[model samples]
Target: MPQHRALLIGASNYDMRGIHSLPFIPGDLARLGSALRRRGFKDVQVLSQLEGGKQLGANFIKGCVAGFLRRAGRGDTLVIVLSGHGVHAAGRDYLVPEDIHEDTHPFESGCVPIDWGRDLDETPADHVVFLIDACREGIEVASMSVAGVTQWGRQKTDAALRRKVAYVYGCSPAQLSLYVRDHEAVTDGVQCGTVPGESFSIFSRAISDVVTSHQGALALDVFREAVQERVSLLHQAYRKRGNPQLLRTITDIPHNAFTFLPAAAGRHEAATPPVTEYPATPSRSTSPWWSTPASPPSGLRPQPALTRTAEEDRLIPPAPSHSAAPGRGQAAGPVGLPPRLRGSSPGPRHLISRRRVLLGLAGTVLTGVGFTAWKVIDASTPDRQLWKFNTREFVQSSPAVAGGVVYVGSGDGKLYAVDAATGEEHWSFATGEWDASSPSDSAVKSSPAVADGVVYVGSQNKKLYAVDAATGKKRWSFATGGEVYSSPAVAGGVVYVGSRDEKLYAVDAATGDERWSFATGDRVDSSPTVTKGVVYVGSSNDKLYAVDAATGDERWSFATDFHVESSPTVADGVVYIGSYDAHLYAVKT
Candidate 1:
């Protein structure tokens, strides 16, 4: 069964020395938790008001977030919500923890920087959403001056989650999120989250209302626009200066629908039996994407024709605009959504329209007995599991498939050779006792690179081993200055790999003799990709080097904020690699 987890954090009343004190954050914590629980999140952790509405330190929050992420498996869904004071310094934005000490050595910001994914190589959750109810920079709302120094904190959540991620920011990068005191007045255009005398922030309250409403399962794009319109309208009506922003940079967007439905909506899903087994390939064609021609959202009925005219395709609707009160003095709360959408609706950023497809699905076969496809307009690729093998610990190493045998390394400190057809274990070679009595950090996590009849791989014990691919037996071992986290790439007579010792080495493929080595500024974990006698790799020092494959001499280098651990993949004349800064770059040779 797929798991659903939520981490809701509200840090108010922070240690005044290091951070500002917010009194109403407890309300946000409680309200957001209730909203997520209502939306069918089975595992919800709400941490706020610890020791009477005040957490002691930043470590507490980090430990909790790490633990929460650890609980989520690859097939799970995770939602993380944060509400509190936020600070931006230099070029990075940070979520202020209770004990942030900006004046200390290395400035232990007592904060969680947006680079929270630095500690994670991968995550198990397939769908992760982040809802931030804090401003990017600090501002004096009473006055009209901004006090913060840098841009707001943003998450490369898509890269970290290794899945689909949607983010909703409370305010614009340079704006401050306001917390207004309630004044009882007429609220015809007011939304449901804020009340006459409520203390909730305008953004958080709006988020709760939308997630619990009938449109709870709104498509990601529509949902983003809807939330933006709601928050923007409310802020504008109240004469507040903040605007909500949604950042989704990943390309090749899918049409899958994402609904954070209410718990009552989940009760029906919970009653269904779990799927214990599945056939690799289904006989029938079953895709969440549409095979039939799209019909317009005229009403809840099928179309007379399969195709639409070009003129009709261009009939896209503009986003409906709401009028703000003439005297902008805190005009209204959030905008309330009706059971069925009304007024004007806008389309997706890339698609023709989300409302059009959603409204059209009412009469189609897509509104199935149980599952409803989120993105029903595009054709979805077939998804199926080929095989499975448990490796005791995490499998950070990529598998090398050769001669019908799949060679992979695990955190268990073992290299496994499994049958490619049936996933049965053929043999295993242990370099340490990582799964047994060895230290937790010890393991054989390097990917195996096969060439000729030898399997070249790195180990955590600071050694590179050449194992016989067919027999899983060690042929030779070469020592390095640091752990061998880089996967080996074989070209010509050289086996090239990088080590955490801040060097890339070229060793003889058969004899294990060190032929040449190149030094870099920091650790080199990126596996080498060879193309046209040029060896390409990235380093912790934020650079991608193109070196002479034969002489290990400097060719040319491209610099980036390359917290790069990704192996460079060469295709045609491009070298593709990913960095911690959340960019997948393609460099031309």
Candidate 2:
């Protein structure tokens, strides 16, 4: 029989003055322990200074981690969780311990390096999982200037018998995981005064919610996805409520459908059966009922299909004229969702729209608009039409003009470059072949950025492609962990872009190599603007960040009342940006 073992370490208090005490870490540790035990993890060991009353040093953590791994053998699964101040120094990641101080370097003392797979590969466990709830920045400590963990990704080489490995980070690599002051609002069945100042990191609360809400086994990938989405939406809610704190998760795990927990009754899962064996991957013949799509709840009709083109392709919905209010008879929340999970629907900025595409063609002195149909109008006389070009699907991406050519992306997964003077197609580049079932699959919604004879654009296929502007041929493609919905901004030999993975990446423009990445608290659909050694960008976390162009280190951040997807415009040392909160801001650069 397979066994499941877990080691949970929470370093709430720190010896260094710069590291703030996480008063809520103890509660988080207790909550996770109870949750895991009810899910068949009987042997759960928790180590923390606040709860266990023991000082955790680098050596102590190492010993405990080694012992935990050694206890597990073949057919077993091991889970390790670290909730503390995490630091990145000298090109390596470390977890700070209770005894860690500002005086010493991590190499000599105070921290434990996070090279888990080094020992993990030698372990006999069939699967290993790591859940880290910690800040990725060590820069808060006056002594440490560099910060952030390495982004999680599994390499091809691994032990053959180890079926899977998973890493779920509380926030993306350089982003901060926030401790919520209003924890009760997020979780169910919480005593008001239990653990005074009771709180939990946004990531931890989301995990607990997902675990307790289900009645059956919870798959790891599903757990990760649900937690990420919940945290994102929750952060948005927080922003609206005047709280600047927000968080989102990053993971390297794939959707192999591995069950991480066996369900029990009630939200607390108070009563649980003794574990006999770990849950195995269900075979297709005996798949769980939830594996298949469920019918819509009774009385609800299917979502109406959008009007389509002659080719049977769905047209992008027109932009909303104004903020949509809940219609009559509907509660004051998003129309389609249940009341428990409902909130105000985001404005047009949140949803991808086709009407936002527009560009100016200098060669013909025309203004091109992609409002349902691609049309060119004389620049001098707005009423005079010049020419029109039709695409198989809605033109969703704004066009780019360069060297007397106009390039635009469509929902049909193609990027077309046309002659500016005549609107004749110069060349068409297909990002990906269309799928009948998912017409928007691999859609090229990101606007194109032309620089140095290369046209850089992002596709829903999780790649940022650099195409030859003259020939329209693919030059290089950089793959991200999530869809590349943000447009590319090129400057100083680097291509800066954001991805749904919650990270803004800086890639070497000529070589397609990664220079650095800065993780935001949520997805980074905001295109970056580089000027004067600083890169200014916005995030779904409702903040505008100014980061060092060379180091990716955050210089400062300004919070807004809503998500900031608007690309920053810099002039006269001031950055102008907009937010969904119905406000425009101008900040000194």
The parts of candidate 2 lying over 4 Å away from their true place are 50-52, 106-109, 136-139, 148-163, 182-197, 236-253, 265-589
Q: Each candidate: what lDDT? A: 0.59, 0.63
Model 1 stretches astray by more than 4 angstroms: 1-24, 32-83, 88-390, 436-440
Compared with the true structure, the alpha-carbon lDDT of candidate 1 equals 0.59
Q: Cα deviation of 357 in candidate 1 (Å)?
A: 25
Cα deviation of 363, candidate 1, in Å: 38
lDDT per residue for candidate 1 within 1-589, as digits (tens), equals: 7766788887776554534576566665665566556556788787776765456466777777777776788767677887777665655656667665445434425566644463333566656667777673333322212234224643233222332555556764445666655443223433233334445566765565455332234545555555555555445444454343333223111213334333333423663222221111111132111112233233322101111123212321211254334422222222234212311233212223323344332222111111122333332323222446776665667777778777888767788887766668899988766644233245666889999988899987788999998888888888888888899899998999999788999999989999999999677888999889989999866788899999999898877653577788889888888875546899887
Clashes of each: 12, 0
lDDT of 2 by residue, 74-193 (tens): 768788988887766664557878787676754324587766555776787766777878663332654565444432111122322223566566764324676656322321221111
- CA lDDT, candidate 2, residue 161: 23
